[model samples]
Target: MKKFLTLLLAVLMIASMASCAGGEGGKFELGLVTDLGTIDDKSFNQGAWEGLVQYATEKNVSHKYYQPTEQSDDAYLTGIDLAVKGGAKVIVTPGYLFEVPIFIAQDKYPDVNFILIDGEPHNADYSTYSTSANAVGILYAEDQAGFLAGYAAVKDGYRSLGFVGGMAVPAVVRYGYGFIQGAEYAGGELGLAAGDLDIKYHYTGGFAATPEAQALAASWYNDGTEVIFACGGAVGNSVMAAAEQAGAKVIGVDVDQSSESATVITSAMKGLKASVYSVITDYYAGSFPGGRTLVFEAKNNGVGLPMDSSQFRSFSQSDYDAVYAKLAGGEIPRMTELDEKGSPSVVPVEISTVTEVA
Candidate 1:
């Protein structure tokens, strides 16, 4: 009886040690909850995942990502729940859609740290704004990125430019506004009057790469618009398709999408990967700026055009450097605050022919 009891005690000790080492195949310390997309969407999700992967690999930490079953608040919350169950100490949620969901999860799982990108946590009706001590919000100066793309396009000899936005959301609105300003600035630099530059701006009212978006892009390209800055999520894909068919140039948004299509001249990029990596690093270093919103801009190398891949005729890297320095040094003006209707309150450039297509 004594020998049998000793063997059982040894087995129980081994089981306890195994549990402490993390159950099953070991729990992932870092988790990413994708917002309505796959890890390789080549946009928001991909950018965040790339950062997570880079940090995890360098630190030799376990990380994984979970895609929600649907694009509803409940589905997103469920994704967070799953990540926590998988031993995720830190969770990264990308996109504005997670705003409400993260608001709920922050209180529900106070022990879990959250990195909400592109948005802050709020209630469904936005009547309540709260950032728990365990969460931080990340925002970018998207207007700066858009400005770079516009200036590059004009300097590259594209006189007639167009902007096809996915939706009239705040981010998209800022991109359009900055594009117009940048083009106007370039016109001044090149000795062209305001009316000499023609810009067609339209919002597609949705973020998908739908047939209607493609049709609208096709119309713009067919009408002699030399380059169209496609500033939306999957909406850029539609514009790229149209540009390819029409042999027109395109400016990509969000990330460097030059690899997606040959027609892509350059991309107005936000440092999604860099921001994500920085936030995660801070979390591990015990310096996480919890309960605060972080803004990334040109001063921190947060937004710019992919210079190496840009197909510019005379706008060399030096030209880009000068403009970027001006922007960083506050020599260039940023876009005005967006109104409730998602429109810029101020328009610096006299866009002679701004049209809104249904």
Candidate 2:
């Protein structure tokens, strides 16, 4: 009888320990839901996934992430439900596309803490919606990063540049506007002049590579645009194709593209990996910024430019040092000024009669 009692106690102890490790009660279980893109796209999805992975490994916590096979409300909701049902205490939803689904999910699962990157829920009146106390929104100053890239391009003697954006979202628009402002700044500060240098902008309306992005880039290349900033997910990959064929330089977004595309000149980096990692780490540390909106900017090392690699052998080391210093020192405000409605506009730098190019 004593042996039976001892064996039963040992089994209970083991079960209790396993439950704690799996976050069965109060421990943390993190889960991430990727947008339509795969986790390996080496862009937004990849960065967010890396953060989650790093946090999980460091904390020795249970975590998982699911990539959507399609772009639909159902797809996002299904992934969220899966995570919630899987014992997730915290859920990270990457991309602006998840805004609506996350809003609804936050209501459905009030107990699940959510991190919504790149967007926030809004009411019918367009005001920020008050989600459950468990949801936090994350955004970045994309315009500042684009501005740095544009300034660097002009400083490198590439006055004519093209911007190819994915979707008409606020993030993409900020990036485009920031690029224009930077080019204008360089033109005024360095005397490139309005007509002497050209800037073109196009919206692909999607994040993946499509014929539209390639065709638009081809047109820009034919018109003598010296560099292109591709600000879409896989759509940016199309810029590489155009650059490889036209022998023009291109800037990447989210992640460094120089390694993937030998024609890539540089990249406008958002430090997505770091942002996601920090949020998760905070949650583990009981300091998660829940129910608040987090904005990452140059001031926070949230956005900036990447180094020139083999693809950009044209850039001198001095060039990198100069731009990096200016940006880090806050001597250069890479972010674009915007109206209250989040419309992209040139603030602080006033350029009269600035027109879009064909």
Candidate 1: worst 10 consecutive residues by lDDT? 349-358
Per-residue lDDT of 168 in model 2:
65
Q: What does candidate 2's lDDT look like per residue over 1-358, in tens digits?
A: 9999999999999998897466535433888898866778787778888888888897788877776668887888898887886788888888888888887888889888898888886543455576567888888988778887777787677867888887767788888877877777766777644376667777777778877778778778888888898988888888888888888888888777778787787888888889988887787789878778898887678887766352453556676566656666778755544544433444444432233433
Model 1: per-residue Cα lDDT over 139-246, one tens digit each = 888888888888888888888899988878888888888887788788788888657788888888888989898998899889989999998888999999999899
Q: Which stretches in model 1 have alpha-carbon errors above 4 Å? A: 1-25, 343-345, 351-353
The Cα local distance difference test for each model comes to 0.89, 0.77
Clashes of 1: 0
lDDT of candidate model 2 versus the reference: 0.77
Question: TM per model?
Answer: 0.90, 0.82
Task: State residue 343's C-alpha deviation in candidate 2, in Å.
Answer: 8.9
Model 2 alpha-carbon drift over 4 Å, by segment: 1-28, 123-128, 308-358
